[model samples]
Target: MFGSQPNGLSTDNKMLSFQMASDKVKGILQLKKYLEQFGYLNYKNSKNRTHENDDDFDESLESAIKTYQLNFHVNSTGVLDKKTLSKMAMPRCGVADIVNGTNCMRSGKKNHHHRHGSGSPFHTVSHYTFIPGNPRWPASQTHLTYSFLPRTRSDAINPVDKAFQTWQGNTHFRFTRVQDSSNSNIKIGFGRGDHGDGRRNAFDGPGGTIAHAFPPPDGRFHYDADEQWAVGATPNSFDLETVALHEIGHLLGLEHSEVEGYHVSLHLYWSH
Candidate 1:
């Protein structure tokens, strides 16, 4: 489902050209969107579209691949090698990795004074990060009331409960499940594709994006119902507790960490 422009090389050891057939444009477009969404690539100048509506591998895409490689500690080559494709295929949260074009995950930038520096997203910090604005719950609002909406899965109930407990055990925040979603601090449920938040926040199917959560004050948590979800120790299905824990982290004002090999992006069934 993927092709590479591995042959393209520039005089200065950069990728000036690459290999891609017009026939492979479809998959490349998918890859393009993926990179754009996660913040590996962007198009600020419409006039300078490197690909230029064509199907060939271009400089823009190569740069995006290079950024992704740098983030994931892969080889700096801009080529879409087999390892790159394998990493991209992993299931991950729907959250954007680069908030406002600033990467939220990358090692060696450690700061203990603040989680996010400059009262904005950019931070010279450690592996774990927070949202752009660092929107955390109020100090007085440590106890958060949570509720499950109509599409809440039964198997997810216990796992979600356990996840909340895990959060409470570790942090000052406490979560309580309630029957009222309207008044709840966090609302969680299942949805498929464009559930309600609009097309921009739609779920991409089972393996691409398993779940998404809004930061503090906007407690909209959603899971892709099309996924094969399990409670615990189930084969060939993603564990609800695992994803629930990651999503819960978002609700508690934490963003995805830059730690290598430790992420919410995984298809647990791969080994099984």
Candidate 2:
């Protein structure tokens, strides 16, 4: 959600003043990928649930806790609060390696405008294709057109390029970077403003929100101007590669993770 207002340093000062709890770190660590899938913390009760009945296994215990909370219509806080602790089938230790990197920034908290709701239904398989070579070079791929925007620095250029490359390497998609031409299928532009496939404005929030890709066939992507991108040694502070990986997942017909409901259970139990 990048189109929201750019409040600048006053917003940063306000954010810096707030303190987050240690528990949040553990929650983040445990739920990182889950959050990426579902986009938020929303846990509800499970119906037609069966207990694993294995007291010895930690996962079984967790499932039991989930069942207990669901049946009772209480929030499955997941944390070992006083009420949950006694009912928790197996006790687990808190994670030590919590809160290592930057604080996770919310999408619309500031004036940043990019907002995501449930996306279109996912295809059984992704349709995008990938073309080889560095995207910065004109000879790379067929669908892409690349250009250096003077407003943005070279540092920004390199990381954003890396992010796109990383996505191509990891997924089965056909894409290529080309020189500026209106005929190109996908175009990459660098600047402070918004760009991408969705109707939502692309550029929003602080630097950490990084870059996003357009849905495929026209898989355009862009990077934010505010960030200080590090190419080689530090692996770039914001991990542009990871963000691109996620966005490319979007471009390839995947939607934000849906809540686990009867539909999901049916998919899990019946579908391949």
On the 0 to 100 scale, the lDDT of residue 132 in model 1 is 72
lDDT against the true structure, each candidate: 0.68, 0.34
Q: Over the stretch 1-272, how does candidate 2's per-residue lDDT look in tens digits?
A: 11212222122222222122222222222322222222222222323123112112133234433444442334664333443322221211111101122111111111212222333222233322121111232333434444443354545556556655754544344455555545566555454544433333444445323455444455455656555445543532444443444454444433222222311101110111
Summarize candidate 1's per-residue lDDT along 1-272 as a digit string, tens digits.
10111211112212223343332333566677778777777777743366644545667777778878877767878877766776676677788777776676653332343343243222334235677778998889998999999868787899889878866755578789999899999999999988998786898765777788998988888888988887775666777887777787788767766555544363111111
Q: What TM-score would every model get versus the actual structure?
A: 0.80, 0.37
TM-score for candidate 2, residues paired by index: 0.37
Each candidate: RMSD? 8.6, 17.3
Alpha-carbon shift of residue 41 in model 1 (angstroms): 1.7
Q: Which candidate number maximizes lDDT?
A: 1
TM-score, prediction 1: 0.80
